[model samples]
Every structure is written in structure tokens, then in C-alpha cells.
Target: MASSTSLTLSQALLARATSLHQSSTDRVSLATFTGLKSSSTTTTTTPLLSSSRRAANRRCAALPGPARTRPGAVKAVSVETAVGQAADTALVEKSINTIRFLAIDAVEKANSGHPGLPMGCAPMGHVLYDEVMRYNPKNPYWFNRDRFVLSAGHGCMLQYALLHLAGYDSVQEEDLKSFRQWGSRTPGHPENFETPGVEVTTGPLGQGIANAVGLALAEKHLAARYNKPDNEIVDHYTYVILGDGCQMEGISNEACSLAGHWGLGKLIAFYDDNHISIDGDTEIAFTESVDKRFEGLGWHVIWVKNGNTGYDEIRAAIKEAKAVTDKPTLIKVTTTIGFGSPNKANSYSVHGSALGAKEVDATRKNLGWPFEPFHVPEDVKKHWSRHAPKGSALEAEWNAKFAEYEKKYKEEAAELKSIITGELPVGWEKALPTYTPESPADATRNLSQQCLNALAKVLPGFLGGSADLASSNMTLLKMFGDFQKDTPEERNVRFGVREHGMGAICNGIALHSPGGLIPYCATFFVFTDYMRAAIRISALSEAGVIYVMTHDSIGLGEDGPTHQPIEHIASFRAMPNILMLRPADGNETAGAYKVAVLNRKRPSILALSRQKLKQLPGTSIEGVEKGGYIISDNSSGNKPDVILIGTGSELEIAAQAAEELRKEGKAVRVVSFISWELFDEQSDAYKESVLPAAVSARVSIEAGSTFGWEKIIGSKGKAIGIDRFGASAPAGRIYKEYGLTAEAVIAAAKELS
Candidate 1:
């Protein structure tokens, strides 16, 4: 049956070629060949030269018709002719070889990089960079530029090569030479901060693919919100190149499935089917048919017989993929690893290590190339350089359209301009909801919800959603619409159950959104482990994404230790550019939101309590902004004998304990330390004034671990916190059982005194 099918496909291709080649204007009638083959066949007739002009055509015409030959033999000859013709691209052929050579030279220069991908998948990357992608080399952050992600980030050489050839400012010759070195624009992986053309930081196997989904999501949302009936302003596609390693990683599956569910038509992934992995052939572990799996996930799947020699086919497939308006497309392009390399082709040896001087010379000779190191033919460089202006022209056109849009819709235009500039709306924090001391006790999450609602009313750019816990996480803004699959105007997002994807997507949205939109994502604090890498990237890139995490500690009842967060606070605090704020009450929660919105240079995580607490008199917005402050004064005045410091729900306990200690004749001061990271950033005079060094005796109270608190509490001080995991019970009961009461704080304070 396979043989018969092949013969029939060959005959159909020959017939289509005859019809297309004879037609002028390079346009052919695709409908005339209908029913000549199976519907799966994407056969289109295009003009080809006479049989005398091509050796392959003469050979093909001389062969006997399909009916007179063995089926397998007929199919093989026809496929060879078709592949030969597909590979014959004056523009793309030279560009593909350039990509491969540049990749080889760059990696050889760096002495560290995975070279197999750049050499093997050069055709795919070449087609994408030269003909398929749309972006501005002059302005890498062009809001409507197509996003390209290298999901198999070990193949950074491939992306760097394309960026250099395409003329992005981030990848100069010096940067290429300095690859993997400290402070170089070209890092080992595609880091957005390090490279201009890079959309997200990707080195971990599966992150880039998931980040692409986020970028696609952002495009859809912006298109929905801003595009007019005539002005399709916010439309752009996201393209990703993935390999065996990316598919094997679980995060890829998680993101791909979610993208399929959302039916993101703007997302197109090209899977490089090289078969070889770092250890050897992929059959050692990954054996599933990747194309079928993606099809099962509701993606439009296309298979290219030979990616290395089928540049036109890959290009055609990508064009056809763009027409798929209902679902994202995944094209599996079968490629030989280290193509054109005589000694290392199809082997794992070429995956990481440099091809060595001798082998490199041999590979160049095999490909009929010159021997000079880092050599590039002038003609080839000129061919790729033609694409440089295409992106700039595209951006210029978009800018003209934007100018017209601004005239018609001034407010929306200004809003979008603010987002583009990464600026917050003026006086955006003035509307932050404030709570008085007499206000009723409420969970911090509820306070957060109120804050979100207030901000959403005043700040149209505040967009986010919770990870399948919107109701519980209290991340929803009633004033704004929900960002559903089709509803782009919705400000609030419903990320469903995909936590990792949500976090990465939030990063993309935050990075790509015009300066004003503060993109955020939420989930239980314990589940942040799933999205830690993405969160770290947001911090590293300084994307300013707010992470709202609830169910902060053992105070979360009955869900047990699995749901409770023990090390989450400390873990987040350790991240370099992230601000971790655990607010104590409603007012402080409002303050945290205010700070998060105003912060443009750093990302923030607002840790909120699931349980309600009294609106304390000391929980002032001004005091919270200082990161930490003396909320209560000592009765003895001149200097406190002991200082009680605490955060979140424990602050109330510390305040109560300080009152008790003062009554017992020990001068006591209570400090509301909302953010340890922020407190540490304050000047020594400010920190000493808040917690005077004269008062060496100090008691630090919190619900979590005491790992990093010693630095703040000092040698003579102690921390009153749960050193173990939490249990499943009522929050009040758990707090008492864990000795988190005011009595425990007072005892610790006395001991320190």
C-alpha cells in the first residue's frame, strides 16, 4: 500500500509541475488538480523550465509512466526530482548556506556552543530570517514585529547567526566572538536583555516554546483591544524553532497543549526532526510520532521530507500555516544533523563540541566551499543584507499608521504610547484604595482584589489573571473584562490550570506591552515552584510583572503542607532584581500594589494572607512604602532595650508582644518589617534608626523559616518562626499549635532582652 501510494503521489507531482511551469506570471490554477491525489497532498502546479534546461527534468521525462514501473521505484525518482527543484532557490539557497557557515564560524570562534542545529536546520532558519519573518533591525522592539523564539536554546549559535545576518544591533562581530563570556551581548543562550532581537531569555530546554505561546497570547490580546475595523494595528505572529530536546521536556508539552486549547492561530512552530540527541539517536528515549502528537493537540501539522534540501517546501508550508486561522501550526521538518559535514553528519559528536580544524576543512571541501577561516563570499553577504531594509520599511509603515490612529483616537493613542514607552499612567497611584483602622477585618487577598479593581478603573494597562484560582486567589478585577480565548479586550486573564505557561506569558506580555500595561499572573504561593524560572527571567530582564501569590503559609487550612508555602518568601527574596512584599493588612496590601504599579525597573511578588486580620492602627501606607518602620514607640524613650520585628500576619503579634514587654518595665519597640529585601536596601542610618543598634536584643517573628533572618536579628537576637512544614487544620488552631501567638512573641522578646 505504501509503494502504491508513493507511485500515485509521484505521478500527481509531475502532472502539477507540467501545468504550473507552462503558466506565465508564476501563478498556477490549484483547483484544476483537485481529486488527482489524496486531500493530504498539498500539490500545486508552478512554472518550470523546458526539459532541455534542467538535467533532472530530462531524466524525469525519459522514465516510464507510473503504471509501467514498480511503485517504490517510481515514487523514489519523482520525489528526488521534486526535492531537487525545491532546493533550487537563487535567493534562499545562498542564504541557507550562509547561515550554516556563519553558525560554524561563530561557534568555532567562541569555542563553546552547540553547532549541530545551526548546521542541520540552516534551511529552516534561513527561510524564517530572510523571507518569512517580519521585524525591524533598527527597532527590535517594534510592537507589531513578528516574534521568533529558539526553543532549543542549546542551539544559540543558530539564532545569533540569523540576528547578525539580519542586522540586529545586539549581535555585532565582537559580540559573536565574545559568546559565552561575561558581559557580552551574545550569551550562551538567547537572553532578551543581552540581545536585541531575542523576545525572551531561553536556555532551559522548554521555556522558549512556552514563552512563544505567551507572546502569541499577547498579540491576540492587543489585537483584540486596539485594532479597529479598518486598522489591524496589533496583529503579529510568533514563530518558534524546536528540536528533540525541546519536545522531550515536559514544559513544552504543557505550553503546547495550552496553545492548542486557546487556538492561537498566530503561533507557528517548526520542529527540527534531526533524530539525533546529545546522547545519540532519539529512539533511546523519545519514540513517539511528534507530528501526530501535535495533531492530537489540535495543531495544523505539515511534514517536510528533507528540511535541509527543501527550502521552498518549508517556505510554502509556513505561508500555508499563516492561513490557518483556527489553530496554531507545527511543521515537522525532517533534517540531517550536521548537514554537509562529511565526518560528523547524523552523529551526536557534532552536537556540542567544535567540529575541529581538520573536520571543518573537510566539511567545507565536501560542500564545495573555500578554506579561509570565517570566510564569506561577498555575494552571499549582499544577498542576506537585502533583508535588513525590509524590517525597517515595515516599522516605518506601522509608524505612519499609528500617527493616523492617534489623530482619530487621541486617548487610546496616548494610552498605547504610554505602554510603548513603558510609562505608567500619570497619577495612577492616586486612586489606590485605602483602609482606615476601623475598617472590618478581611483577608489580604480580598484587599488585593479591591486594589486591583481600583487600579483597573484608573489604569487601563493593568492586565493579569490567576492560574485556575481566580476566585480564591482574589486576582480578578470586576471592572475589567476577563481575557478569554477570543475576547481580547478583557483586561483580566483566565490562565486556566497552566501555571508555568501563565507565568511565562505574563513575562512576554509585560515585556512586549506598551510601557503602561502592568501584566501579572497569580497562583497559590506553593505552586510558584512550577514557574520559578520564568519569574527569575522577568526579574533578570526587569520586565516589571507583578506576581500575586496567596495561601501564603500554614495559615492556609486543611489543604495541608503540600499547599502551604514555607520557603517561598526566602526563595523569592534571593532573586536579584525582584521585590518580595508580604503585606500585613488591607492598607499595606494597597501600598504594595501601589509600589508594584509604580515600579518600572523591577518585578514584584505580593504575598497575601488567606485569612483575615484586624485593620491595625500601625498599618499605614506611608510606613509600608519605607519597607520597614517603627510602628510603635518604646515608653522609656531614649533607647529601646529590645526591638520586635515582624511581617504579614505576625506583625500584629509583635505589636501586642511589644505592648506587654513595655508594661513589664522593659523598654520595647515594635517594627513593621513588611519587606526584608526593601529594608536591607535602606541606608545604614535609616535601618539603625528603625532598629537601633543600641538595642542588640531583638525578636523577629514570621510564619515561615528562619534561614535568612539572622542577618536582620543579629547575634544577640532570635527569630520566632516555624522551622518545619505546616499541617492541615483551621488557621487559628494551626497558628496556636505552632506557637505563633502573641505570648510566644513576648517570651522570645524577653529572652532576647
Candidate 2:
């Protein structure tokens, strides 16, 4: 068995050699240098050898490297030597090793963490941080700084190491030691809220890649909106490091396809193609040509033969990516799994587990690291500190340029500054349009259009585009210029059919821009599921993005069950810190907008109706602000025998039901519940006053599922809702078929009573 295993390994190596030879002349070659015997056959024309050589040659010709040579003649080079020694190769290598040691030590100290990635890809991280990236460490949120994302977030040690070494203010040695502990800056996974340098919270694989695309989109939007011919204020690149697991996620495919379609040239991704995953070798499941797949998505694809030490090659690939201004780029970089450990290196055993004290000591000794655990050499620390200065020079230089730009272009500079700091212009809220009962009846979508126009007039930094449903969603603000490719004057974005990308991009815009502007995106409420992941990130990041989702329910009649949202409201409300508002009338709609805009640390979704709602006589802006209000009181007494509660278009049904109940000798009260999240947030006294424990006979009516309504209406109370998906029919027919009418509400009220 041992001899057979050796023979198989030998055959594999010989095949790799032949493939490398052939790859240079004809096709792209991917060679694995894993268990090869030196005693393998030396025949030059061995099929494997010829194929490998041709493949290798083709790959070399595609990159900006030395001329192709004989397949077996390729020399193994260290990272510093690969990128160029003119930039202090020794210091760079020391910093890279420092990152590796810190990661291993921190993980070992914490007794928890995925250590394989940091150990394997330290060279890539070092190259990007010391040679390729540009940023002001003093200000991690520098407006034009390049964005870096660790898409494989379980390997957060990789990111934490870079943050600390790069001198980011939030990461420290103690933070590293406190990893995975409550209140620690270094959590098990990267969280933007917990750490200053984290671009996005990314543990659910593929999310960070989507977020990187969003960041790139934000950069493009900002550059189009704020950049002048002479001042490229918003130009910056978004870089991401991903692993095999990240590629396996479906969301990654969705995001990458959209990124490729949108032609996000500023987005560059380095795929750590380290053949190993938790399950085993990638060949066990994944075998597609990743490079070809990316090429199909319209991305510029490149490869680095030895990612573990090819720092020069990595740097050159990034530079080449930057020069291509037409599409996003992906560089496939092959690397080992656990780079330095003796027994565990290149194996899954070292993926998540910590090396024991004995093993760690041996590994450190092997690597020539003599210091104690968590101890850094003074020279190494000083070297890295010098590479990424802690001084205020970058900021000071930018301030001078800003001062000069302000002098030359005062209005533009002020607007740009306002946006960078996340401050709304004075009296911007005053421009929010108001609607009265006397106005002509129209769909809530149309009312939204007027509101958008009014807000656009006052808020110069308010930017958003819609999904393909812009016409129906009424999300367009005609007064503002359209955000088009290569157009700097336009502030309004056009996201085409990319709803998921739009949501994620809005998060990026909120993150990239300071206080001056509030980024938003619009689409049908049903489509929110497509962008739900991005919305969660917005809530998690406290990015004040507004999701204007129209076509809120079954009332979106003929579009069929697929377009109708039956359980969306309940699903959205389930998310922590997300406000879901469904307004009944124009006044309440405006109130929802007010609360949404006022919330600077939370994300809000305005679920607007496709049909017009009759203006209620008692509807007022003040009542809407309170989240829920008594639209009508019982004429018989202050205490009502039955309560009819409803939201959105269903409120009208509840109102009619209340009138009928009154005729039946019941003291009925009608309440309009617009925002459940906000209402729940109200004081208990206020809540008790609104619901009143005395009112046991309560009926809550809505066109959606009954999941969340149970909290508002107790077990004894009845809820009238469409518990299942809708069907293709006219709005009125669907309402009748689903029992969404005043009669249904009256029956439910009677049953509860």
C-alpha cells in the first residue's frame, strides 16, 4: 500500500510537470507542488511534463513578468524579491513575519480563532499593506483611502494583524490577546462596529465580497457626484482577500456577477487559492476553472504561481489591475495552508486548532523566532511603524489641498465636506413635502415621488437610484441629475436591475461618505429578500440607509404570487435594530419619512402601497409620529368593548368595520398602527394607554401574514391576515378572495368579543 501510494504521488508530480510545459505554449496551467518524489521519471516528452510546460508558458505570457523559460527552471523567490528590492525587501519580509507571528500568538493566547489563513497569507497581506495600499493610519476613515476587506472573516486574525501593524487606532496588542472575549476589539469574526478598521462585518461567507463590490460602487458614485475635472476627491480602490469557502457561497456568485456586469474597475480581489478547506482538498468538490469563470463574468483574471512568497508578483498584478479601467479584477494566488508549522503545515488539522505549546515552540525555533510568546522584536516593530507612519502628515497634506480647493471652489468644497462628515444641511427637513386630505387621491408611490423631489431640492447630498422598477416605485427625483458612468455632475444613481448590489452599495456609500449625505435605494418590497443580507449589514453597521420598498402587498395585483409580499413585513420586523414602517395615509407616510431620516444610526424600510388609501379625517402628522394613534373614538364611552387595529391599506377596512360594529351596539374603536418597531420602543405607560389591558376584544387586520401581530393582539384576540402567498388576480378580487375586507375585520372583531 505504501509503495502504491508513493507511485501515485510520483505520477501526479510527473503529470504536473508535463502540464506546466504545455501550458506555456497553449493553455493556462495550474500546478500543485504537494507530495512529489524526486525519483520520478525524467522523460522530457512525458504527457504531463509537456502539458504543464505549455500551460505555464501561457500563464507567464499573460502576466507582466520575466520571459518564459523551461518548465522545470522556474526559481522559487521570496515576496520582497518578487515585488522589487528597491522598496526595502528585508523590512517588508520582517513585517510579514511579524504579522504571522502575532496572529499565531494571539490565537494561541485566546485559545480560540481560525489561524490557518493568517499564517498562510501573511505575505499577501504584508505586500498589500506595506507596498500597495494608501491610507492615513491616523484617520482610518479617510475619505479617499483604499478599502480592504477580509471576506473570509473566520480568519479575522489576518485582518487584526494588518490593522495593528498598519497602526490603525482601534487594534492593539491587548485587543489581540482579548480576542473572542466579550467587549474585545478582536472578535471571532470581523465586525465593523466592534473594530475601527473593519470595513464590514463578514462571517457568513460571500457577504464581504458583496460588500467590497458595494464599496467599489460607492466610490464610483461619489466620484461621479463630487469629483471635478481637476480634483479627483472620491477616487479609491476596494481590495478583498477571499478563500475557497468564500467562493462556495451563493451570494458571492450573485455579487460577483453583478459587479462584473456593472464594470466596477476599482474592485480588485486576491483569491487565496490554498487548495485546502475544512472538509479536505478542494478537488473533493470544487473543480471548476475559477479564472475562466471570472473571465466569463467580464473580469480581468490573473494568477500568481507561488502566492506564499511572491510579493513582487502580487504587487505587479495589483498595479496591472489598477491600469485596467474597464472591469473588476481577480488574481488567483496559490498558497499553502498552514505555512510554517512542521507537522500541520498544508493540512486541515491546522485550519482551526491551535498548535500546542510544544509544537508552537518548535515552530518558532524553526522559523528563527527566539522571542517569547506575544513578544515582538523592537526592530521589527520599529520597521513596521516606519512603513505605516503614525504621524499626521497625510491628513495635514490633505487639509492643505482641501484648503486650496475650498479657496478655489468654496460651494463645492462645503458640500463635499458636509457629505464627508455625515451632517445634513440646515433646514433640509423643511423641504419634505406635506400632503393634506384635500389633495387628489393617488398611490403612495406617487406621494413618495413628490416627497423625493422636495427633499432633493434641499438636500444636495441625498443620493439614490432604483432597481429596474423605478417607474413603478416612483423613486426618481427629476430635479437632480442622473448618476451616469463617467459623469461627475449627476448625484442620482441608476442601478439598472441590480437590487442586491444597490442595497449593498448604499451601505458602502454611507460608510465612505461622512455625515453630509444619506444614501438610499428603492425597489419592490418583495424584492427585499434579494437584498436582505445587505440590509442586515446596514443595520449591523448602523448605516443610516433608507430602503424605499414600494408594492407592499397583495394589492400589487396582477404581478402574480411571485411579486406579491405576503410575509415580508414579518420577516423584516424579525431583524434586530431594523425599523419597518407601513403607513396608512399621506400624513403617516410623511411621518415615516421623518423618523427614517432622523435615525442616523439605524436603517429603516418604508413599505409603501401600490394603491391609494383614502385620507382618514382624523389622520394627523402628530399622531403618526407617535407610531400608532386612535383615529376614531367610541361615541358610547371612553372605554371601548372592541378594538380594531390595522396598518397600511388595511386600516381603511378596520375603520369601516368599526362603523359596522358600532351599529351592532358594540362600542368600537379604530387605531392606525403605522410603525410596529417604533410603537414597541415607546414607554410602557404610553403602550398601556394605547392598547389598554381592559380591551381584550382586539382584532388586528393586515394584508400580510399573522406572525408578528400576535405581540400586539394577545392569544385571545383575533388577527385577519393573508397567511399564504397571493395569486394572479385583480386587486379587488384578491382582497375578497383572501378575506381582506371590512367584513373580515368585523367578523374577526365579533369572534374576539
Candidate 3:
């Protein structure tokens, strides 16, 4: 079944086929699919469907459409078959066509979107929603159900159609009609937030696969943590359908390499080898052997010669993938882009454009689809009646299994249940470290490790690692073993040097983690550019990822300009829905971690330091939660002449500058601006209290770009920072050379005052 074929799901098929053929009062609708009909034979070679496909279609929610399909319009499998009768082949074809047409109708309605993917990949969609994956439309978050990710997310219409047909309330006909319009459930791409059954926000090429790896990782971890040998829970596969664009992206290589290295047996990716891209044929820019590449990365590769019509091959590939319980599988399925399109098949013309009304009509004729727009034939509706009920039954069975498990292992069950409900253990926050001025000065990175280790003791949901920089990044959870092939129970994950993949993988963990586990990723602050796309996805998808970025700014030293992050702080601060935190000392570091833990709807990037920092007297966890606060003010009992702001290593500089200014008989108020995004979320009155509007004399001290600081410093204030690349030297010298010092801040504050 593969270049490295190991086993097949023959036993699973026997069980699956039996359950499907069992006597049932309910029926599932079927209305669509174009078989790879051979001219040489009378027996149409219906694409081979795997065992998962029979149950797959049973779960399909049917959409009621017009009264009929075209006379002799590729006769569909009838839905009125009796029990024990091999499920109607015609019904399967009809179901496949329904999906195809639904996608076309949505794309046509939107008047925008990539129609080629939906039309071409509908068969695979049917195989997954109808046959492969298992999920209840009523409760899309069922713990043990398989997950399906559409890596080619531009064709979200396909997923939307499946959800609608599969009876998921997440996408109704009205939502489908809205298409890409504002406030629609169906956006330009599949958004997990917008749809219930949607697993992760995908579409940026290789990020989805990385996310899939994360999902599989979470499933494996949970199974190991909670599952007993007799009552197996957390058994599910993470299936991803990726296209040529996804394969071409380098992030795919990073993620897939890890997927193989980790031996994620439940990750089954379908490589949609539709050789067409936006510009033209993929051969123009992408000509590498994907199969060879995956194999080199230690993946089991399978070649499906005729994906369009070879249903048997697709089914068999999945069966074989399931049988191998050690490594991930990549099934390369070659299909024509815009399949069945008389004129545009296999061409880029069908990639992103709406097939014109004329072309649509011609195509409808070409494929024998006579139903009106958004029509789901009734026979199809009847066929899908069993999916919802079947899903409910499956969920009930799981609940019963879990009930038995809970009875035997009370503590384990309670923990698993807590995770599923997104609840932290009682008094988990008690482990956070507090600091006093007498506490020895320490690098914020070192303090960050303390917070991480402390939190690890309390929060089981908190698990993370650095991109091959766990030591330098200080992101390791002490006493926790590494998450490797053999030990999925370990909290620390070794993501190698793949920063981009690490971010994407973290997104997956956040998205699929049952109880909303907070996944964190770390690297030097300077290297964020390498993983910006994944980070952007994390923010966009609301995957509350904690990005523990150490070696912030020139303080990283000796690495020079190439490693100094001059503009990164400003760049990330400008980004929406992310906390860009640069703590001053031990207390602020704890406060930052506290805020990060509380804000589970957005991502947080802690820009920590390489140099030592003394704990400030007035810093508190409560103040950090409020976003920012005054560390020292009105010591002389008069209106402050100037307000000083600082973050990270520069906070000490600002504090020292404030001390010098206060000695000169000027009242100075020092404010710790730890998190810009969090600060912006605070009340205007709160912001004004921290930085009074009446006091125009102010200065901001930070070791990065001064771009966004103007929002706080104002026109009358000066900003002390390094706007350019730094030179090779020790941390202290680099800071001094860049003018990021107490003396420079004092001079700037004096000028402003």
C-alpha cells in the first residue's frame, strides 16, 4: 500500500462493514460523485472507498434541494436500499455530486474564492466527512472523534457544504448563502472560530500540517495520560488534505519532518497532487519529488494513481496508514484541477476565479447536474438522516466508555474532565513566584524559567519547548521529560530548529487541546521574523500561545546586528490581539506570566533579557494584570515634572534615571510599560492615570525601536532606544553603545522636563 507498506486495516474493515450493514431504520442521502469511468469496461470502477467511508457517509448531514436530478444525468445510487444490502453505489455517487455542486453554488454566490479546489477535491471531502472522520453535528467538540483539516482552506466552501449537509448547525443554508460576505459563518477561508466542526484555521500553505501534527500530539499525550489499557480513550487520527501550494511552502518541510521524526502514527495527510497553481502549472516553479522528500523525512509515502476515480486506492491507503502504528503517512493523490470542467480542467484558469455562468452551465451539462443552485435532492436528504443519529449514538457509546473509565480511575477521570472544561486545578496560580528588592538580581530569562517551572508544577495544561534553544531560551519545564516518540506523556516538546513549524505546531495544540491547553513556543526575539507567519496565524486564530522569546534586543550581545531585534518589539506591538510583554524584573516576569495565563483568547510574546535585572519594589502581579502601573511616584508630595516609561532591561535604566532626576529636585513618576497590547485594553482613565495628559514632559526607555512608543511618550517627550542594528560586544557595552542607559534616559528626561 506504500513505498514502506507495513499493515492494512482488514480487521477494522470487517468491523466497520458489519456496523454499516446492520439493520437501520434511518438512511443517509447521496447525490454526488463523478467516477473514473473507463471506456474499455461496462463495470464502472467506482472509486474504492475505505471502511471509514461507509460510516463516513452515515454521518453526512443532508441538505434538502430541488425535487430531481437530470434524467439519465449520471444515474445516482438510490437511497432506498434495505438492510444488509451493500450500501447503494448510486447513493454514494449522488452524495459526492451533492458536495461538488454545493461547493460550486457557494463559490458562484460569493463571486470570489478558489473553486478549483472544492470542485476537484469533493470526492476526498466526501470520503472524510461522510466516511473517514467521526464527529457529532450537535456536539462538534466530542473528545474522541477524528479531526479533518482542510490545508487548502481557500476552498472552504467544500468544508462548509459538508458541515451543512452533515447537519452541523455551525453552517446553515443562510450562512452558506452569505458565502464570503461579512458576518457569514463561511468566510474566505475555514476559520475554527466561525465553525463548530472546523478544527484549526488553515490556508497559509504548510501551517495546517504543522497544526495537524500538534493536534495528533495532543491526542497522543492525552491518551497516554488518561487512557487505561482496557478502556482506551484519546484514539483518533488527524487527517489533513494539502495541495501543491501547501507542499511547496518550506514550513511544510519543517512540520512534516517533525511529524515523521516524532513517529505520529495517527497523522494521515493526503497530498492533493493537482499540479496547478495560481500562475499556471506547478512545474513552472515547483518540480521536486514530494514522495522522495517525505520518504527522506521518514514518512510512509503512498501513491494513488487515479485519485479522481480510484476510490479503492484512497480507501486502501487510509486503511494501511491506520495499520502502521509508528509513523505518519503521506498519500499522494493525483487529481485533475477543476475536475470535469470541459474547458478549464487541469488549468490555472479554474484555480481562483469563478467559473462564468456560461462555463457553469456547460459544466453542469458536462457532469449531468440538473438541480438548481444550492439544491440538495430529497433522496439525498433521506440518505443522510442516519448521520446525526449515528453521531449521537457514537457519542453516547463514548460517554458510556468514559463513565466506566471514570468509575475505575476517579482522579485521572477528574483531571481529564477538568482539561476538557478548560478549568485550571484549584490554587494553580499559588505557584507563581513573587520577588522583593533583596532578591538577587537575575536575567529576566532566568526569572522566566522560574515562572515556567513553578507553573509547570501546578498547570498540567501548560507544556512547551524552544526551537532547539531550550537551554538559551530557558523554556524547559524542569523535572519534565522531553516529548519524544516513546514518551508522549512528557510535557517538554523538542521542536528542533524549526521556529516556523514550532509556532504552527503550537497553534494546533491550542486549537485542538480538549481543555484549552496553553501551548508555548520560544526562540531568540531576533528570529521572530523567521516564524512571523505562524505567529500571525496564532493571533488571527485566537490560539492563546505563549511565545517566550529570550535574548531580547542588543542585550543578546556578541550575536551583533544579525541577532539584535531593533524593530521587533514595535512590529509585534502593532499587531492586533497579542500581548507584547517585556518585563523589568522578577516580579514583573511573574506578573507577565500571570497575565499570559489569564488571557487565553490571544497570544503573548514575552521579550525577556540576557542581562541581570533587580526586582522593583512597587511591581505587583495585580499591576501587570491591569496592563501597566506606576512603580514609583510623588515621593516629594508634589506634581511630577516628568513621567518615565520603560520595559525589559531598560526599565532599570529608566528607574535609575528617575532617581537621578529626583535628586535634582524634579518630581519623577516611573511607569512600567510591560505590555502595550494589554495596556491598550485598559480603561482610558487608567491609561491617563499611568501617563497623565497634563504632564507633557515624559521619556520612554526601551532597548528596541522607538516607533510605537510615541503613542505614550507624546511630542514633548523623548525616546531613548536603539533604532539601528547593534555592534558585537558584551551586553553592557552594546547597551551603552546604543545609548540604552540610565545616563542617556536621564538626559532625555531632563530635556523633556
After TM-score superposition, what is the CA distance of residue 620 in candidate 2 from its true location, in Å? 3.6
lDDT of 2 by residue, 1-753 (tens): 123322332233324322322322122122121222212111111111000111322222112123233343222222322232224656666677778788889889878888788887888888787666666555455566788999988889988988887776567788888989976778899877677667777887787887788778777766766677877666778999999998887667767886787678899998887777888777777777677688888787766666666677676666566667778988777676667777677777778988778768767775667777666677767656753442234433444455556667778766776666555788876777666667666777777777777777777667787887779889887876676544535666777777776787677666655344577789999999888888998888777788999999999899999999999999988998898888887777777777887786789899899998887767766777778878887744347888899998898899998888888998888888988878887898888777888778889999999997878888789889989889999999999999989988888787777
lDDT of 2: 0.73
TM-score of each: 0.87, 0.85, 0.88
462: Cα error in model 2, Å: 2.4
Against the unseen true structure, what C-alpha lDDT does each candidate score?
0.74, 0.73, 0.77
TM-score of 2: 0.85
Q: Give per-residue lDDT, candidate 3, residue 650.
A: 80
lDDT per residue as tens, model 3, 598-706: 7776889999998888887788888888777899986443358988888878878888888888889988999998987778889988887787778888888888888
Model 2 clashes, total count:
41
What ranges in model 1 sit over 4 Å off? 1-91, 635-638
Best by lDDT: 3
Model 2 stretches astray by more than 4 angstroms: 1-87, 387-391, 480-482, 488-492, 635-638, 663-666, 751-753
Model 3 RMSD vs true structure: 10.3
